[model samples]
Target chain A: MSGEMYIPTYQDMLDAHERIKPYIRETPVRTSAYLNELSGAELFFKCENFQEPGAFKVRGASNAVFGLDEEQAKKGVATHSSGNHASCLSYAAMKRGIPCNVVMPRTAPQAKKDTVKRYGGNITECDPSTSSREETFAKVQAETGGDFVHPYNDPRVIAGQGTCAREFMEQTGGLDMVVAPIGGGGMISGTCLTLSHQAPETQIIAAEPEQADDAYRSFKAGHIIADDAPKTIADGLLVPLKDLTWHFVSNHVTDILTASEEEIIDAMKLTWKHLRIVMEASSSVPLATILKNKDRFAGKRVGIIITGGNVDLDKLPWLK
Target chain B: MSGEMYIPTYQDMLDAHERIKPYIRETPVRTSAYLNELSGAELFFKCENFQEPGAFKVRGASNAVFGLDEEQAKKGVATHSSGNHASCLSYAAMKRGIPCNVVMPRTAPQAKKDTVKRYGGNITECDPSTSSREETFAKVQAETGGDFVHPYNDPRVIAGQGTCAREFMEQTGGLDMVVAPIGGGGMISGTCLTLSHQAPETQIIAAEPEQADDAYRSFKAGHIIADDAPKTIADGLLVPLKDLTWHFVSNHVTDILTASEEEIIDAMKLTWKHLRIVMEASSSVPLATILKNKDRFAGKRVGIIITGGNVDLDKLPWLK
Candidate 1:
């Protein structure tokens, strides 16, 4: 890999923001006095859940999809995701009048498949296993020649996600710390890329579900740790960190925290009760971490990224 | 009643907005492309659900609570309600550091009671009948010498509610039609008062559940139509209209529409899905009506008021 691959500068994020502005929402910064009191910290929630495609993934997806050259765009974009990234990429591609091919596990939620299809995405199903998915995705990419946009590991996608923290700093002035859930570390890496350059004083924290603590372990070990199928209700944060993400994670992230399953669920319900936003389980990890480690965040102005709102209403964790 | 009771002018709404600006939030306006396509209308949702007390009732409640004279303020405010109005009034009064006495039905939701108490409002339980509630409220008012603030009928409350429509018009640059669910007609009357004076070109529409269609019947009959303990999933909108609200509803409202229980739930779920907000079932009436009568609203700019988000999460109708 080229040295350029490791360096996605603040300028890249600025460019991504400008490029994706027309295709994405400048989602609102929301607050809850009740939540602030409960955590003993002033919390500002960057509500990416309100994005048109219902996730911050849209920002990265739109940046990558919109940045393509006419010739490259004509061939379209492809990704392997059964989560927000698939639908978000599809939405961005559809907005830019390009085809999007999403390879998903056949067992993926029907609601997710419906969203991807609704956004004009063509889906190719694979077996549930990672090897099968990879094999199937490789064949699809080779056959279609569509540009592969890795969910979080790509430099372009990382730069796109970093725009959120830029907007966050502008919207909330500046925060003492910014926390977000780590799936494949796209958002955390993006956050690190922006805050480490723009507001070095501000801390970047990555929250992970305890059950899927590969990123947490990686952060402590100073190396990438890959988890095959860690189970958590925060289905959106199932993926482990890749090298590109690990590059940012190891260098800029101040701390990586973990929340237990029960804590994550409680925080999710609390946010719904207090913020009144339909956020996903993955989004609640930051709040869960804050609540669990109140001493670390208390009395600080904290910004929490509410990642997405695309959960299956029929299979809500609390109901289950 | 005095002639002034029936004449809450646009000036009142303007003054109310200024008076309550310190206490109540100028809630964000949200939009959903999916909802726009489904209804065939461009819908701007004024999310009063984001209010501190989780409802638009706070606008009116804050106005009444804050507008009280020194002598009257000493007694604080008293109201009898089993819904958002009760907690909202309590919240407003508490913000002003005054006593708030709410006479609620004994069977009211525990969640509602907790919120009222959390806001430092004292609650008095009634027998779940209009007569009993009124009697209980009278006793509380007489004993405490607290000023009575009717849920909808009071001119102060009507003026306060009108501020929302003023903001809605400003936020979305004035819609072709502004629709809100009519219970005792507080919010609808407020919309009528503001739109009739400030934006006469904009039509004001009231929506109600078919099961509790007293507002619809009243609009058609040109008189008040009260239903005895009407029941609908939109529990916030079970009250009947009073004289003060009736004046605005009859004079300025262009239409009063009704949606079935199933339609209301469906629209509520759709908004939660697409808009990603936890709005009350009553707030979904406008979207339900718009979907039911698409030809009338198709291609038009419509403003829908998301009145509240205070619902018992444990008892979500869809889950049940």
Candidate 2:
């Protein structure tokens, strides 16, 4: 019953793409001729990494922000993120000239916070400990009368993220497999739902960080799994699973694959070297999964969604 | 009379894109929403910067290698370069299973040489002077019975490079202006000729480096102008104007604009930061021109061709 709540129809994705088209980019699809030959598979990279605010989160954020009723939208939008979503929400709301509030863990990277600031978001820093951020966000929302914008879990948010799959389908038509990184399952949930309806024959693989294996665990247990401690360079993926996302992922997903941080970093470097585009560690998760499970996808037409590109070039350790 | 020898026909470009379609990438077209808002003009980037072998040279190289007759193809290929052309030729020939030799200047960056090596091209280094590199390449061609693949002079090569324009015409059919970076004039020649026929209403602009203003001088003097010990940060644009490219450029090119090296560097950084693509100095030339001549292009639909991205990170001043 819970699973059915998240399995959206292909038509739903199409409508969502149309709704968010004004706010989000129909990011280009890049092909690697060399990689295609080497892998003996036709590969299409849906470069959501180049989306507005530099990640696919903009799709979900913009959709969620726009979905808010005039009464709710007038109060402005609030979200807990010092990452892509924070920047995305700020940018989307700024486009509407609406005030935005972001509750960021104090430990969040400076680059991400700077991004949010540039887009006119009011920032409230909170302790990194679990309870502090939510508590601070609640206080901020109470004072500002802001509507809460969940990063994922909400139907409107997942529907917004689903636009990526819709564009992928339009650009490359169909694929034998669709692979995307799984954090709290926003991207994967949208992808699995969209693929199951649009390209039923296509398999959906969720690539997760090994250190943050909550999504993988949730997939196996058919319930939400929360990890208290997570360590990985994929900072975008440290968040634990949510009940709504778990509902979609458990029913429509194929299987979850995990990649070590080192593998993710290597993939990120390879993308930079060969593709000539910046890719963050979390964005490289799908490529890492592909590297780990090479045999599972031989000769199949594969689509890889590069989810984000908010990398700090000045501090990238691997560059040295 | 010498200038008349370089003119290219519109029909040749249309045919070239068709002939080279299977072997080359159309490359994606990117529209920067922020730039559009900033300039009050819609802008499209033809990112040949992401082309195979990291630049638009591959379009020419692939055409030259594949256009060879049975006997010529069997003889293999050779060329002399200090930039994108060398790696592109080597890569094209290697993909066709033909032996390739490149006579590169000793001053050419090591990273470029490594790209040639990875594609299995035999390299013979000579001094940076044109005559010396030509002599070395001649000797290698004579000894190895290889066909010489001139970087930009040959009709086939010019026609091949024109394929990039073909794809641009396909992606963005109507444009008020089309701009391209000028080096040996190959890329712009192809573009001008193609757009002249395919999109006759479009105005064409050539953006060249101030230090290496051979193409600009040629356009002004109505003849091919050779660089006299010119210097510029755009390594791909080091060469003086070749005779064949001069004719095509002269007849169709509207005007040429030159930019300072600092402007080019700034453009490079902006492209990387905003677009997330690491474009080299040559690829940044059009953007540099746009920045310099902002008043001229206001409220117009402008298309810029980003020529390549095979830059060495270690040698980059920004990295330092």
Candidate 3:
């Protein structure tokens, strides 16, 4: 499974869905008439924020955890994530009654660290840099002999994330286009994988923060653009796209759009105010881009994937 | 309909459900595993906050606005409310293409006023006192000859609000008890009206803020006890129970509970952090009471009605 990059097929996603059914929620899709009127598009929100662990990453994490063989499961699963992925993996591992180890940035939000700890995941902190994360994660994995589940790069994770798109399409009947926030491109790549097969006509759009516009730049340059410790209010979207996710993003994504940090924050507030849901700044990227590029989405049936809702209530970006 | 106090029967609720089906939302019910574990109860949250107008009052507002005769409709509808009821009534009036005259305190939250205006309701500001409000409302009603839609005291409104409990029962199969915040007792009265007949075994509990515990005092004293002006973070629950609402409260409510201002605020933040939904502090009272009195609710299947979500994002209670 590790020699060459293994590309997951549609059948893989179908199989993952059945495997994770007991652990993941088929979260409800919500709509806002006011938002529809403002955006000039009929919008459907796939509320992954409503997931039990409060994120869509659970789908992929559950797939990877449950898919492991009994021998491999005993060693448990490990990942390096600064946010939702770390906690989601921990949650999945806890459900399967196995130990989970996480390598996270020392500076990650306390709320995120609390979630991972609450789920009984052992956390080893690393400096907030790619080199330090990899180095720390390597040592942790070697010591524990745990299965490494890459947050977005692995085939099993991407296929697991693809199930969200399948549910979204079924819930909305069919959409003209689907928009999702892109960081490592896991959710976007998964959306592309599902729509490219099930509903080819539905365009896949990736939204990114202008502060961390690596994905947008990569799409324009036709090559991955890795950033060095990029900073943004959308902390979840700081990572660069990996080769496996890049393959789908380069081939299937119709376009990659970027929104300013202010726009992202504003959209987050607008969604909370109008849609009446508590979601993270990262999840607001898609809506920010859609509102900024209204002409592109006007009068279309658009599906927006709300990736997660895990945020610090006391220190909201707007208040800060 | 006006001579004697008409109690809304179960049949009235059934009819109201059908009549307002097109105008209101059958808002989704949500559950939180974390909250369930913390409270020692299986809790179902009937998210009235998800309504298009962002409240359960829309059901009652829609019932009154749409059930009017053509002669009364031509004159339009009027109400005086400081919060969700104003916006919700305006929303219903706009749907029926009738003029909605809202008499509101000049100091009502700007967010609330904006909503009523956005829904095409005319706002006639009055002083923040019962006498001033009634005097101003009387002048406005006389000038327009509009029918007054009492926020909770009207039979039509009570029947309409009862539909929420009907949906709650259907969504949860059945619950051991249902808890709702008692403002003017509109929502609580409606819950009692529905459960008293539809699911007679289900107990109806009313929650109130300790700061403004008129309902709690009234229940204990075996009579009405109105507060001239009670201050609390739960601004929605400041109003006293009217005669019609009192009738249901005295006859059917199992018990009334109260929570401190700090407790209500903490519960509001906890709900937003865990349930991932934006709801008013007023709606947090039920959960606050449940958390405070865990022994009474342990091992019970309880339904908590999330009354509304029209809060100023810039001024969250916890942030303040």
What lDDT tens digits, residue by residue, belong to model 1 across residues B190-303? 998888888999999899999999988988888899998799999888888888888889999999889999999999989988999998999999999999999999899999
User: What are the lDDT figures for the candidates, one per model?
Assistant: 0.91, 0.82, 0.94
TM-score of each: 0.98, 0.91, 0.98
Question: Residue-wise lDDT of candidate 1 within A210-286, one digit each (tens)?
Answer: 99999999888888888877999998998888888989999999999999999999999898888999999999999
Chain B TM, cand. 2: 0.94
| Clashes, model 1 | 0
Worst 10-residue lDDT window, candidate 1 chain A: A1-10
Q: Compose the digit string of candidate 2's lDDT tens values, residues B54-128.
A: 889888888888877888888899888877888989888987989898898888778888989989999999997
How far is A188's C-alpha from truth in model 1 (Å)?
0.4
lDDT per residue (tens digit) for residues B1-320 in model 3: 44588888889889999999998888999999899999999999999999999999999999999999999999999999878888899999999999999999998878778889999999999998879999999999999988899989998999999999999999999999999999899999989999999888999999999999999999999989999789999989999988899999999999999999999999999999999999999999999999999999999999999999988888888877
How does chain B score by TM in each prediction? 0.97, 0.94, 0.98
Candidate 2 CAPRI level: medium
2 or 3, greater by DockQ: 3
lDDT of 1 at A157: 93
Q: What is candidate 2's CA lDDT for residue B58?
A: 88
List residue ranges in candidate 2 displaced over 4 A.
A1-14, A37-41, A106-110, A127-129, A217-223, B1-6, B94-97, B106-110, B117-120, B125-132, B197-201, B217-225
Greater-lDDT candidate between 1 and 2: 1
